[model samples]
Target chain A: MFNWKLLKTIYLYDGTLNGLFTIAFDCYIFKSIPSNIIFEDNYISNFLDTAIYIKTDNEKSSRIWNGLYNNVSYDTLYNCYYAFLSCQKNKEINILKYILKAFIDGPKINTMLHIDYVLEVMKLRKNVLHESHRLKGLTRLSEINKNLFYASIHPDNNVIELLGHFFIKRFPLQNLILHDKNRNLLFLYNSQNPNNYEIISSPSNFNISNYSIEEIEFQNLWKTFFKNISIKERTNPRLQMQYMPKKYWQNLTELK
Target chain B: MDIQEKLEILSDAAKYDASCSSSGSNRKNSSNGIGNGDISGICHSWGADGRCISLLKILMTNCCMYDCKYCINRRTNAVPRATFTPREIADLTIGFYKRNYIEGLFLSSAVIKSADYTTELMIQAITILRNEYNFHGYIHAKTIPGSSQELIDQLGKLVDRMSVNIELPSNDSLKLLAPDKSKLDIVKPMSYISNKLENNQRLLSTFSKKRNFSLSPVTKYQKEKFVPAGQTTQMIIGATPETDLKIIKLSESLYNTMKLKRVYYSAYVSINKDSCLPTLDKPPLLRENRLYQADWLLRFYGFHADELLEEKHPNFNTFLDPKCDWALRNIDKFPVEINKASYSMLLRVPGIGVISAKRIITARRSFSLNFENLKKLGVVLKRARYFITCNGKYFDKISSFNPSFINENLLMLEKRSTPSKNNYSQLSLFENSLPTKGDVIKCLTGNF
Candidate 1:
């Protein structure tokens, strides 16, 4: 364990929400502010500086979470969580600044959107949520092996948790497994554990789950319907690309 | 014909409908069913034309008896016509829904045999989807204008929403374009559906055990079920000489009196070479978009249709959006204080949307907001900076409220946001079409 008391300029963590929160807890306890925060995988020893390595502790993170929940507005907590979900580079520093501001100015710091850190966090949260909402609609479920409904998406943000909660309410009885292949996150939900889904992370490891015969036939039918539905005279691909961009077409059943 | 071929013709025919929204309906999948209606409709895919395909918008048949000149499937046209069996439609809907290809079904038909027969066929197809299949998904059915009230009532009870197209804006346009459709024949079903929805709400309010059922619930035990998503209508713009003033006035009446959920404006596509219809290479899409913007002003923004347009200025300006145009005309309301403006006043600003306005209201309660705060609150500072003040300091260098000065600068800002039609640039070397907003409006009016 690298000594956190050395007063490092940059703190490195494992790039988890809890890890970020633990770093925030250290900043408060040490009464020293770190200039930069980066993920552990991104950290390289710069001979000009001291480096502090922090391990994730759920207890410490939850303590900070509970403190915010009791002190600040619930909307602020959600904002912080959503901002953390953003795939933007160097988001750790943005979220850390927001947390520090939240501590200094009380819970109402979120209302001060003119503050650079608060505004950036808000923008990042909006991006995360906007992509989540789009994926909820664009998510296509296919049946695989016995009864599992499987879907794969490659959203910019880690939105599988958001998509999982949406599908759980939408299809409460069905077994579901949504894989965010971009982040290698797997969300598994069954009727037995419908409300609290089990999320696991690994490499992009799942094969195409052995699609049922009906699934293949229906996907072909969907492609047929997608082709037949468009008007020949009014074909405008620009508009379609505007709504559903080409970047999102790789995993889409109809587009594929 | 097989199902695939019939689907091609029917889906092609149904593309004219702008009522593709499956919103305002909520339901749960039944024990045996495979689907339910989403509260906010989901766009499973966008079509090549950029329209969202929320529902399986298809017609029961392309067979028609009436000779409406604007219609692609008019009786006079020699296009190959096809019809889908009720079983075929039901099968297609279920098959597609299970695969997540659609939210539900938007089943419509041309006048088959008679109005009653066509409506009955639609009802039969929907009935199979609802009763036989136990499908609880969103179903938006089109009511044949002159259908019997009994059939309309049966149709309304089965689906989540219904519509009766008002086809033309005025009686004269109907007389000229669709000699077979009388004004009475079209409006009768609209009134019937509107009255039925009101009655259903009243009965539910009085007798419903759960008054918290603001969200329409599809339970087997409920006694009454009307079109919970309500009714919507569409009018073919640019097909007639009706001005924007006339179009919105009719829309206002429909919204105010008939209790319509929405009024769709479809830019008229010049399909067949008819002497009555205007010749156009493309539909008046930008004009249609402008009318929709004005329509939003009426529905949500608390602006009257008269305020947006009147007899003096019968049409909307092609370059500026309606709200910005309204704000420019009402310059006296400008320079509203960010910390002091009312919600309505804040909403009237060009770049300040509903979300930003709400944020402004809430954020100001904590501190007196400044220009930086306004931008941070999601206000489009470029457009909004002219109309708003923070701490009594003007962001833009403007001493006068002259509309043209502001209008010109605002157009420059708008020009950045919307791509200028390069189609004009390509034609400029050959034809000296003046590149002005007026010329755009003139071109929109079919003067080209």
Candidate 2:
């Protein structure tokens, strides 16, 4: 085993899966793990830190991807992918350590929750998937034109891609554009091509105005139903806040 | 009435039902369909009362033929009434479904003219949604207690789940409160649903085995299931004097015999002041909560009704949950070895739930866990610390295994944990006094 502590190398990448996997490929070739992995845009130089900017290569990334598929379990692979989607600090290194540990310990590494890095990786995955599931239920779509719908969300994690697959299946005949305002990413889907979706970057202030007249009417109807459905005798706002947090209330039509 | 006024009356009429679950169905969307069923139900929003808004819960109409005393829209009560045309119901379901405001529609109604008539109206609304709109989302419909078997069967084939509310616990209470409904009226639909679901299961297995059978029509309908998620029912609590033990036993029997998906206990909110009903300042919310806890024990925790409460102890202790109460009474099962205990044994501990028990089992396979690791595994160490042993070592905070002593400590823990003030109430303008020293001390100690 190479002594990673003596080298103290910090690898920088472009914050993409291919970029991170290429770094993983380089670590195996050099027989030494980097002391830390930092996204290139967020890197801060220091006198003691030796940062290496590894160029992302498709050949090298595919090699590591094939290695992981052949070695680790399917859950471990997906956990690595979802944990990478989380914007939590130091998640990249934890995911790397988890992947490397899975390679060494086989599929049983997921059960080893006692390990610190494995638990952190699992928690990151849980956090991202939880946000994705919440936004799937909470994302409100409004009709913009005749057959087109639009929804805007500000989720904590980059989960617009995940929600695109879900809404496409549920509304296969309707055109949809899901906006992630925080990440400035948009998921566009057309009813004609139900199988394909596009994630493109746009400005955060790109708001869709002129909602259909029926849209406002339905929003009022929903708010009225939301108000009347609750029993006044058993009003418990604390429990409601616990399930639907105040931070997510801005995107909800009824709460608004 | 206008549509908005009708929605106000109908939705207000339907709010008493506590069954809002959209789960247990796996219906997929056909091509060009507008919606699909999610096996794990999704809640788009929560109401102010903290219940999930998974389905558009509204009655087809608030006009009733019967005079149930606890009902808000009974025949004798002078309340505003409204009904929705089948087309309006279909349009509302599709509109709300498109906006992701609800998973699907939960259509219930008061008996307008006859049981068969109401059931036929409900079937008409769902038919428009299914055939005309091609909506495949979750639909839970209530079966009128005395509806014919043929009508119930047709309704079941269209909706995802069917329910018949056993509005009262006992036959005596049914007679006292609901004069028009009989015990036979409720049980007939329940048993019919139970037998039909069973027969569907049998047919499903046999038909799948013989794929080349000449029954082309049967093969065509193989995709559609008869009440695919099965049936659930609701019962009103605290309307009449029924012991907690009797309620639990009834729920247990319903699960075993009727094959129910769930049994919802609705706390009887006094809608109309009647001579037969008890006048309460608030609904029996705590008792209803305790019964739901006991119901969970019967369904998931491998617990029986007799194990939870005996004939002498007919009700639950208000301070402790049923699991903790059971654990304290069965104290011999204490200090279960965390490293070696079975999953079911781990679940019996006060603070360890199903998820934590599974976590402990999976985690212990790699390493022997200690107290610190138990907390990380999501065990409520405050409660489980009294009952569990980490590698043969008891939690150091407790000194005695005596049942009474542990019981007193657990009670104290419960008392300390419950909030002294209702935090979600409306702000009072008249009572604007500052807190005194005594009040501050009480607030700090959770004793008011």
Which candidate comes out best when scored by DockQ?
Answer: 2
DockQ of 2: 0.81
Report the number of the highest-lDDT candidate: 2
Q: Which stretches of candidate 2 lie over 4 Å from their true place?
A: A1-7, B207-222, B422-448
Q: Which TM-score value belongs to model 2?
A: 0.94
Model 1: per-residue Cα lDDT over B1-448, one tens digit each: 8777788788888988988898998876654456777777888889888889989999999999989999999999999899999999999887777656788999989998999999998888989988987888899999897889999989888899999898799999999999999999988889988998888777765655654664554253243768988999999999999999999999999999999999999988888888999998888888999989988888888889999997899999988889889888899888788899999988889888888898998788878988776766767787787787888887857664566878888887776677658645544576865689987898888544
Worst 10 residues of 1 chain B by lDDT: B214-223
lDDT of 2 by residue, A108-196 (tens): 99899998888888888889989998887899999999889999999988888889989988999999999988889999999998788
Q: Write the per-residue lDDT of candidate 1 for residues A90-149, one digit (tens) a residue.
A: 788888778867866787787777677888998999999999988877888898966678
Give TM-score values for chain A, per-prediction: 0.91, 0.95
Pairs of colliding residues, candidate 2: none
Residues forming the 10-long window of minimal summed lDDT in candidate 2 chain B: B214-223
Native contacts kept, each candidate? 0.52, 0.83
TM for chain B in all models?
A: 0.90, 0.92
RMSD of 2: 3.7
